[model samples]
Target: MSERRTIAIAGGGIGGLIAALALARGGMRVLVYERAARFAPFGAGIQLSPNASRVLYAFGLGKALATAASEPEGLIVRRGRDAQELARGPLKGFMGQRYGAPYLILHRADLHTILRVATEKEIDIDIEMGTAVADFALHKNGVTVLTERDHQLEEHRVAALIGADGLRSTVRARMFGNDQPRPAERTAWRALVPADQLPPEFAANNVGLWLGHDAHLVHYPLRGGSVINVVAVVADAWQATWTGDGWNSPGDKDELAGRFSAWAPQVRDLIDSLPSVTRWALADRKPLRRWGEGAVTLLGDAAHPMLPFLAQGGGMAIEDAMTLGRCLVRGEDVAVALRKYERLRRYRTARVQREARRMDRIYHYSNPMAALRDMVMGARSGQKMIERYNWLYRHKS
Candidate 1:
């Protein structure tokens, strides 16, 4: 019997590219439609925890990633006001030995470039940039993808559709009407500065998280330790008036400095020294019981958008791509394959989503509650702290 081999993937981000590569490796053809004119190195840095790293290694990009990525020695959780270390967890050799893959931190652009290059090399994958998927229709045999480019609407038929389109996914909206992303009541600012541009303190080869009242700051080395990627997430009064396009909007360093004015002097100095910053409002959709209908389904943020507190958003999306590809290759029917994929991923992603939200609250605790939280965190040994997240980092799919 002929296999349902051609798949349409909306979005060209990490998830979409990974899906394309994974599906192509399964001997299926892939078409990726991206709205960007080109796949430029965009966004700040992202951490690839052991769970996601395992998937990438399985995809055979281990060597490339190892060379391009910075493996942080460990994570240091600190009090945002005083820079006092609350807890520490190993990530370098410890994670590799424990989880069979090392934890990596790298520029988002570097990761995307690696995946995009890998996808381009596959014979069955084709990518179209500047083409946005406007809508899609599900049919008995396949899906018809409607895209808009240069004000022209075009349609293409495929055996299936994968909505890896990210947080504000059009395919997701069209599939389940009335579903819109809700602001997570947080805004983030990111800046990547050259290592030489910052003080020796910021050049540490470890991931640092400073948790404060209603705010948190994360920083780690990126691009093999040549740069430091810093992110600040704070409770903001900004309304949801943003139209989604303003994400990654150019931000003023002064405005960000004002927000972190009362933070530790080190943090304030870091913010002041940033050459520039980009601001984004974090938004997420409520988890859905099921992510697809017929031969179409959602992946990544489209399927489950969550808070960034857990640092597993990208990891979960990577796992989704691998699992979906494997299901498609194993199942005899397209719809059945997608259903199995959804079933396998829905619970896991939802749990991560909930955990992320919990982390958001935990990281923003204040005063007496904050002191109690610190004691609890400090009570755990580094190994125990890492073990606590073993369920998350040790996940295979």
Candidate 2:
């Protein structure tokens, strides 16, 4: 008896695209459906820690990723007049020691382009943009994907269905009803301004993180030190929304300053004096109750959406793509393989989501307890603190 061999991935963001590349290269046919009309180069930079970069390197993308990657000397976390030398896990030896891959920090656009282009060149995958997935019907043997057209919609069938679709994934909605997303009591403003445009002090080769009462500001260089990527997160009671490049969403500079008003001079000054910036609320979802059911499964943000505090959002998705691809390729039965993949991934991703939540709170600590925490960090060396996070970085899957 022959089992079905093809797979369908819904969503064309970083996760879906990478999954398409992985599954196709694994000798499985893959078709990726992207709901967006066009891919927008909107996101700021992403810190792809060693854990996820390991997967990227395995895809034979080490060289290409290296070209677009930026390596900061380390992290600098400040709280008011005091600061701490927090952990900066092995950026140097992460890849070689743990998974034979180095950590790569890159602008989201660069990674997107590299993955999309590399997949198109190396795999037999089909990508349809402006195609919104309306729903899916799980049958006895396979699943049928219904896609909405300009005026109508139609169905396409495949043996396996993967919902790499993002945050409010329709596929996940149909599979696991949309529950309340994790709210982190803050808004994150993202924007990319040229390095040359900012104050000379900001162009440093290190990552600057200013932690204040209820907010934090981060700055790092990008594109070979040509442009600076800055992200400011502050407390706001407003509902979390993507607000990405919307018509009413002006890239206002003043609002950026107002949020982190009482922050350290470096942070307040960085915000008020910045040439440009954009802002959006950060939201997350508790780990999905299930990642797979029969022939269909979820991946990346759809399955596990974490706050951006740990800078592992995209990296986790990349890891999900690689792990699922390898699992299916090696499993004996399609159904059995899917189940194993879910079991293996569910625990790890859930842990990461929790860790990210912890980081979000620690980054914005303001009370006396925060001072004690800061004192503890100052007394310890960065490497010692970093060692505590090896569990996160040293993970194989």
Candidate 3:
């Protein structure tokens, strides 16, 4: 590939890998830089709605995803205090039929593996482990990227630079200055339990949502029903006291259990059954008016980090990758193409970020507000509930 067609991507995450694959399919050579020495089995379960699955299938990953993912029958929303069902909505078949792609739930690691393997098979993609994008300089021809590996620095010039380094991204900091992400004042505790270890109700092939006062719980099957992934989010005031090596940190099982002690027996039992859990302090930033400048741009969390209330954090990233690839392949000036990509994606992603925050408020409603929410949700039929988010699910990009 010529220098004009080579793109350097910072961060070997889902967004970065997917961007590489998309760019490769568009006839561009891609180099992916990952700070980790190798991919590790990290993270819990992730819900890939039709919007995300559509892009992955377009990349010929349907078979790989089917092998590792679980297509849940539907989603069940309940009131946490008494486990009262508020709403039930279809997912698997309905989603595929309505939006042309299946909704999938799987371990985060499994999805990462599928993307990694797919990138490895692409001749135009090269992944460099144990390297991090330290800095970059944009010139008339291209961007010169400085990468660090074991305290040594190396420079590579590429037609464009993509900052997919995720939240707290070094690339983003360099591009827009270091504006700290606004904490959402909440913490998510996540764990995976063996299917056989829980009651049948907990192991059912459906996504479960339990909404409470200032907290919520979500669970679904993963890896072909071998394990059940669970996440509990609660209000936290101790962000200043949080100490950890990274966003994901070991959590106190007892502390998590106490948070849900007032809930129903099923909810309490679910918390108690977990052997251990990992936690992340939920946070996001106000949407950016611009994602990049000149030949350098941003993708995924690096561009727009959001709370996980709507389960579209990863989905939006996938959409960004596809949109960016389409924009870049138009043979326009690299900077202009990147700006076009930003224009195409900015509104949709900003809307999702706003919606996720709105959902965070809805899910954590207390008393009268919670009652009104349940009444409104319960009055709607399952199909109606699904249709409410048509804007989100019906998106092709």
lDDT of each: 0.87, 0.76, 0.92
For this target, which candidate reaches the highest TM-score against the unseen true structure?
3
Model 2 TM-score?
Answer: 0.92
Clashing pairs in 3: none
Estimate the TM-score of every prediction.
0.96, 0.92, 0.98
**Ten-residue segment with the worst summed lDDT in candidate 1?**
237-246
Please estimate how well model 1 matches the true structure, expressed as its whole-model Cα lDDT.
0.87
Please write out the lDDT profile of model 3 over residues 256-309, one tens digit for every residue: 988999999999998888989988888999999999899999999999999999
Backbone clashes in each candidate structure, one number apiece? 0, 3, 0
Off by over 4 Å in 3: none
Collision count of model 2: 3
Q: Give one digit per residue, the lDDT tens place, for model 2 in 236-290.
A: 7555444454312445788777666655566666666567665565678877667
Q: Which stretches of candidate 1 lie over 4 Å from their true place?
A: 1-3
lDDT per residue (tens digit) for residues 356-378 in model 1? 98888888887888888888988
Report the error of model 2 at residue 234, Å.
1.0
